[model samples]
Target: MGQLSRLAGTVRPGGRTARVRAAVLEATQDELVEHGFHGLTMDQVAARAGVGKTTVYRRWGSRAGLVVDLMNELANQSMPHADTGGIEGDLRANALSVLGALTDGRLGATFQAVVAAATCDEQAAEALRAFHLRRLEEWVGVVDLAVKRGELPEGTHAAEMIRAISAPLYYRLVVTREPVTPAVAERSVVRTLAAARAGAFVEPVE
Candidate 1:
């Protein structure tokens, strides 16, 4: 849910279109959480949203399409990347945000469903890639700010650094099937920040 919200595009302040999109997206999340991606269907979402099946199919095309659009809506609702002046503080904030989303029951399940779908479905993989790319683009600004302030090396790969901060948490949440707690988030911060501050994220010369 959070992942989708964070990936969604901008919405007009208020309108029939906006209301419909919100309803459809909310239904999409509910379906994803309860049924996983495999169990999600256009008819189910349409019924849940109280929208016509034709409208759902015409607007979103397929289940994967619905997931992608839901992600875009979610993205649009996400707050801008954190800005704490100090790079360490900013990175911690980023980690906390990811942690919050992963630990959230509905959002976490949605992400897990998508992650599993991506393993077998090309469309799902593409949707996941597109959504995460947008999120990384939004967040790398913090690292860029750090570099400009001399907190990080000039050639630091900001997006990669941000990815590093989130990787372990996801791994724990999805791979090892371990608990994703505040302690895990904090460890990710310390580990990623230490390596980043040591220039591990600096881009190599071409």
Candidate 2:
């Protein structure tokens, strides 16, 4: 989703500008992990980043802008779709990737803070929405490959297949407040592939 990039009012830059963005976003995440969205402030980020407050305000405009760019940066840094030569292996890799991210201390805390903020803040909600959508789009390619290889139903919904693999893990992490163990991630892959083989993810003709 390019919505957040548009909201930030700039495309990716280079040289000094890129450095400034990197510093400011790092500061933003540090603040989010320690103080959360409510406690985050433009002035504090500027100070933490060692940049001028005016520069921070001019570049990002608001706390939401900083978060938008940070999420974009993370998305850019995320691993691409796995190619393990089969649907099962690829989906297993996807599940493990989700597990790693959710279990990572700093990254997990950053996401939790944003998810909490999204409930009450429209801008934060947009950032969170954009982040997940970008990830989903990137991972959909693996499903496409599986279909071409006849490993899945011809009309299977690729995005749905990807979502199914992660949804249970997220439910455990955010809803049930239970541990999202590797076993849980493995179960998701096994179950989703079974359902997929049974045509559970096929799209209906309107």
Best by lDDT: 2
> Residue 9's C-alpha lDDT in candidate 2?
32
Q: List candidate 1 stretches off by more than 4 Å.
A: 1-14
TM-score of 2: 0.91
lDDT assessment of candidate 2: 0.84
Model 1, position 11: C-alpha lDDT score: 45
**Total clashing residue pairs per candidate?**
14, 0
Please state every model's RMSD to the true fold in angstroms.
2.7, 4.6
